[model samples]
Target: MSDIIDIASKEVGYKASSGNKTKYSAWYGMNGAAWCHMFASWCANQADVSTSVVPKTASTTTGMQWFRDKGRFKTKGSYTPKRNDFVYFKSDGASHVGIVEYVSGSTLHTIEGNTSDAVKKRTYPLSYHTITGYGVVSDYITSSGDNSKGKNAKNNKGKEELNYLKKILDKNTDKKKKSKRKVKYKISKIRPGINLSVKVIVAHGTAKYKYQVQEGMKFSDERKGAPGKLTFTTFADNKRKITNGDAVAVIVNKRKFFYGFIFSFSPKTDGTLEVTAYDQLRYFKNKDTYISVNKTSTALLKKIAKDFKLKCGKLANTKYPVSRIDDNATLFDIVQNSLDETLIARGKIYTLYDDYGNLRLREPWKVNVLISGQTAESYDYKESIEDQVYNQIKLAYDNSKKGTQEVFVVKNSKSINQWGVLQYYDKVDSKKDIKLKLKSLLDIYCKSGKTLKFNNCFGDARVRAGCLVPVTIKIYDQKVSGYLLVDKVTHTFNNSQHLMDLELSGGDFDSSY
Candidate 1:
């Protein structure tokens, strides 16, 4: 393992050095470069154990594809990444690469080189979202299949042999112990938002050793759900055997524990026999919980607001004298009662005028009913006053005809209370003059609309209709002024007379009109 580590480290250093000289100059010049990719390459190189130089590349996507195409990458997503395999990143392009140090859960914690900084080891979450793919580069051998070539090879091979010798020495030293045993185990970090399976190994001289898994807790008291006895058997060699799919007890220790789960194995490694246990667990963090709440709240609010707005046409501004309010009162009961009483109320209409005192011709008023008492004390009506006034103006323009056209329920006011003023003029005879005049009027109205301040009521003018002469309407103090520009050659006025007639004949406009 030591020899492998050294070789891997050297290979990573080489890659980092090369990358720094070329594409990673910025990183190398910094305090320290990132090591995510370099470490990965080094581990892969060392694991190969062969004399051939492992193929290295700059492209992350291409490198992963290369391995996959060769049938070297693992099929199952859970498989731990071994040394000497390609590490990939889902970046802007196939640009990042690294080697695997170890695989835990769905992520690969690796020591990679060639990052934003110089070569260094970093752990990254492993998933399709981050990793485009990965591939194996080499096994426990040199690429050339030659173990006896250069000085570096000889030195590395000698070190490897020595490490093997050390392992044998350790095994022999343990053999002298008559009560020890060996156990196989796998360790992994618990990941957020996922259930993890853990395998633990225990070994040697156990007098019915008890065990307990707790999240950041001490292994002291069984009464507190601490170290409890595990069920298992002693083998012929006096070794206790445990495998996957075993039930385990998890306990709690200290107050305010942040760690997910913790457990202890007793009778440390014995040369002869071992005990093992496996468990699956999960963790939930704060961010996930918050996101769920936010999404749900936003959706609900949008739905309610949309329905209310559709019924009200536009929200009225309290700053406008044209008072309008919406009531949250249940409409079902009201509609039923109105129908039974045969009570039909007529809608009020008013013409709208622009700041220039011209009657708006194109844009028509839209009628909306206020159910009563739905207004909130804090609601700002000024924000939507323009829309409400425009709707009322549109209603009045549609009612204009040759005779006196009356719209019902016109709210009594201090100015122009009896009826609205509808003025007509032939302006299309001079197209250029009309256009210039219209532009000048619009500029002034827009400026006034921005400058005027009204606490409860305000008004402005806007050009909402006509192709030739154009009509400009001003809405002020709940009264509308409509200006119609007639085309002298066509002998036609730009207005909604036809619409008003239809409404009158069909009783579409309130019968009170």
Candidate 2:
């Protein structure tokens, strides 16, 4: 809350030693630069609001842009000032920034750095024309305590955020120790990136006229938070009813696969048309700042869709409340981060996709589709102790009173011997249960990661990313069977053939359909 004001106030009487050198400028990597924004950034950091409520920057312009991007910026004279909010001033552009200390009706009291070679208390009229704008800092609620109008919240919000951070520190922990029901299917071998396109390109180079407009159409629907992209080749004889910005649908055998607007179409050297279309999810690529208070992920999505004038459909109720500031984030990243919070806190995965032209948010998709190797294909199955697999959990807490660092550790001797002491380390607040938390983290991170991919499976129109499909395959004398979330899927279609390649995640299988 008002902690920023208090911290900045303490520095008000401190003068730069010389050569524009100050503690703030030194920490910001520009020891000799003007330090007003750096001073504000340092104060916000000490207040634990930097980048969460205020931007961390050395340039006042960048900080102003951050507020504007988050829609938290108010032009000068247009807004009533509040504690911890930023006051930016400009001659030509934003040249200086300060922390608001108090507002008395139309008069403003502030603290600024790099002014007259020292930090000092400042006063100005609220309608000062030189004042460019104000960056709103909404998290601090100092109005509740001592009427100081500065400081942190004295409410349950702190506890909730603390718990949220704890959950993030222990993101790998699963309440249930059991894996879901397994599904066995044959698989296909795969390589990295554009498996289908690689083959078509190789074939075209050697076989000539392979995979041209005669191949019909290909559909590629990406997972949650990603725009659905459709790429197809067709002859002009098929009628050029589709144009840029026109709604385009891809259907084969009476099964509608992709519904989106054609963004671009070009003629290939082979006298065939190459077209690309993207679903409504494409719009979420827009970046903006969003502030939510006690709103569920689904509810927030609805609000965002409405605010952007996008269509929405079939949004599942995600009851976990998200109350935080996502400043200057892409809409896709905003939605994904919100869903990820639920995934970490409540162990639930949700999907946001475009159904036809309508934006849809759904719970983890589970279905009865079976993956099989009857199409004369195999798969690449890998389980390795590399990457995020840890056998030991070590947490440290600084003890200022004792002048020493306290260490807590939980380790599996067998895993340590086998995996060679892979450790997950972080600093925890003194209030945390070191032993219990470490044990939970050890259980979560001490396992090998299993990755499954198929490159030559027969295309099924029903298969798409973000959906759980039962997959069964054997690896190293172990029959791995479970519902796998399709991380990405690429489908290709020709006159006589349709094939898909899938990269799936083999953990936390959702049995709910």
Candidate 3:
């Protein structure tokens, strides 16, 4: 007999080739519909079992109904879920379903599909309130952890006994020897205009550097994409000296060139030098300029790119009508503030970054790669539902000459019912700006119900900041499977392993039932 859990486990890292479209697309007869139930159906098909073994359906509720019709459905609290059994949940409605992988004490390990955009395994306690019921497969018995069959069983036992004795006698301690080599790094290349190259040497054994870039800003700050330090050991015979504002580029995680510039450099105690640098955006942040004008958001973005000698990347198409703005802002300030106004007025999200010294503004939408339970060696997940969420938003703009303040309101009553009237308020100078701004605000805040902090996982090399990715986690006793935005990503490669530390956040998705 084929074990369904065993088969499902083999497919742990399987994912959709494109957005929400998987190999099971044809089986479910839908291109991008939620396929958690369909995944279970496909697993059943793999076992070559009749529907009597596990009723096949694409709807989570429908699957539960089918089990009820068979007189096989039992509520979770009343009946303990066993390995290979189907389980369902109810949230805002019937939210999600999955197959129980195994039960360990009060915890249930499950193999689920359509979680965080791929098939994944999750853990939940028996007391998780969202569980609806468990559908038992009448004819399928759980595996006993024994693979031996027929006359081979006795032979396998004899071999195990012999192996145990041999292991005891041959034990010479399997501890691996630790290497004592000094860790160091080398620069493979520098950008074309940087104009200097020299042998790299560090004064401190473990030099520290950090960089951060955020979604809403033209130039990164100390908090995001801020530059750390680059120290070099100097010699009196050496003719070249690394100076402030010189461009430095190095490979991170063997992924791509992390380009930055020297902010400051100084001689250290023993005659060596320590150079501190910031991201390329630091140039814009430190440089000062002023301009007073009436311009569309796109025009302003293009201007900032031109002034900073950056190639303009993806520009949002919305020609936001902004007028009569003060010019007392820095180059980076204008870029960030204007971008914010545009997003609020246009109802879209954009990211600004120094792409290899080229300034680019792009919407974060592309699904570069998949991160699944099997692919991740280890991971840390932290989610937040902060003041960032809103079920209702009120936008007020004053038409000064007209002697009236026009107020536009947007509300998701269904969300309010669940989250209550978490209201937000904003004021503007233009009445024509209220509806569009409120539309964008509601779209951003209402949808982004939760944010995530993911760390220490091996991710696809293509994964980067501003990309869309799906994630699966159990929160508050429910399986929260949904897509998220990779706001910030740090890649580190050591000991032949690539580890990705991610700051992921996303907008509203219906919780799995």
Candidate 4:
């Protein structure tokens, strides 16, 4: 074992005193505080490592920054761990600060402080998701020669490092910069072993970097029809930085806002790059002939996604089974055909959307999402009777037992008088209840098309199409409030600000032909 690892290993079984006080924290003059990073710094100091090589900070964030600033850090899958290397782990939770004791093939035997309130030895796979990256120590120039990369630095210039470390310790640790460069959007390569070691391109609109966003992300989806789309462009250092077919994800305010695959892009003469990406359903737009039997919408979506090698997330079961044949229908049309049949028969709404790259089929929310004045900056509401509104529904069925044609009708007299004779006609199964089916169709069809759109709505990272969102607006001395279906949403991230434009519907749909 290396001297750094050996020194850290001897601290095994060391536990904090009452009130979480530890020798490392005490050495750093911060008793009762977290000391994993302090423990690493202390170990490096005992081994006479230079402050320039290994930072003497008690904060993991500070340590990570120090390593990142020095160009000595490698994200997991990009580098192999060696003895004496410091590794970082897990985000959105208690992160890790561990020292590698040894590398045995694919496993990393590590010695970490404060693993269960004590110094403990642990083992994990080299490709574990919790591992963020490693901080490599450059080979140190010592009296024994240059062995710093693998050898512990001796006290050749210990006095200078001690003074440097003392200066850092004297500073106010609580002092922090208000803004730092962040990688809000991460576009990664979509292939086998994704998230393990694949290449990822990160872009940001940080004011510090001065790369302002010229084009923001736009996303839209039909409730139960076409595939959703996520498209945007940012500054690219080189044309090869982003290639068509690469996977895309937009992380807004630390949460996922959109996910898809790149399909097309164009580069400007001034180095600005414009690109377009679409969800898994983009493949569904390809026309193909397929016949389905005894399959629900969700079932057909999953089947087609699997057949096309697309990833599938949660697919909620749909309520209706449909049998149909399309000579040459776009894959999306086939899925929509099933969705139409199911909703018409069962009066249920099922949505197909990509949830952070994995395509999902789910039912839209029935409950309300209350949107206060603070939530929406401005909104435009439109109600129309000219298009896609009917007051009467007529279904013609052939009765095999009676050997005759049957006509079923359900109409709203109030709607017919107010909106004129707007009739919807379709064919139905003779075995089903004609009266119930006609009434269901009438309720769905006999309504004015109402659409509400919100512009520059405070960006909610969780908001997306196919979900229910509440909207409250007071316009023209009229108050409108309640839940509405999100038909489309576009998020604009510019100058370090995040906003979205949304088009909402009141579950308005046209009957299946």
lDDT accuracy of residue 366 in candidate 1: 23
Stronger candidate by lDDT (2 vs 3): 2
Query: Model 3: how far is 271 from its true place, Å?
Result: 8.3
| Better candidate number, 2 or 3, judged by TM-score | 2
Candidate 1 lDDT by residue in tens digits, 1-513: 112333544544344344345333332233234444434434433443321123333345545655564345554353334443556675545467765544444455544565554555567665555565555542422222111111122223323323333443444345346223332223122122233222222322232223322222211101111111222222322333433333333211112101112233233343322233321111100011011111222232233334433111222111211111111212222111122111111121221111111111122332121111111111111212121011111011112244433322222132223233221111121122233333322221221111111111110111111111111112244211121221111111111110000001001011111
Compose the digit string of candidate 2's lDDT tens values, residues 139-197: 33222221134344443323434454466445543323344433344433332133333
Model 3, runs deviating above 4 Å? 1-240, 252-256, 265-275, 287-294, 308-318, 324-326, 372-449, 459-462, 473-476, 480-482, 493-497, 509-513
Order candidates by TM-score, high to low: 2, 4, 3, 1
Off by over 4 Å in 2: 1-177, 180-213, 237-241, 372-376, 508-513
All candidates: TM-score: 0.23, 0.65, 0.42, 0.49
Can you write out model 4's per-residue Cα lDDT over 1-513, one digit (the tens) per residue?
024765786799999889988998887678888888889888776775655467777788888877786567889876655556788885657576998765655777788887788999899998877788889752221222111123333444443333323333332121123123221322221221122211123333221122234545566665555666766656776423666767666555455656676788788887777877777777887765555666778778877887899999988888577654443446766687677656545656777778877888887754233454665677776768876577887777656688787887888999778878988765443334445455555654577766667887665556667777766667555565545677777766553455678777662321222
Ranking by lDDT: 2, 4, 3, 1
Candidate 3 displacement at residue 309 in angstroms: 4.5
**C-alpha lDDT of residue 198 in model 1:** 23
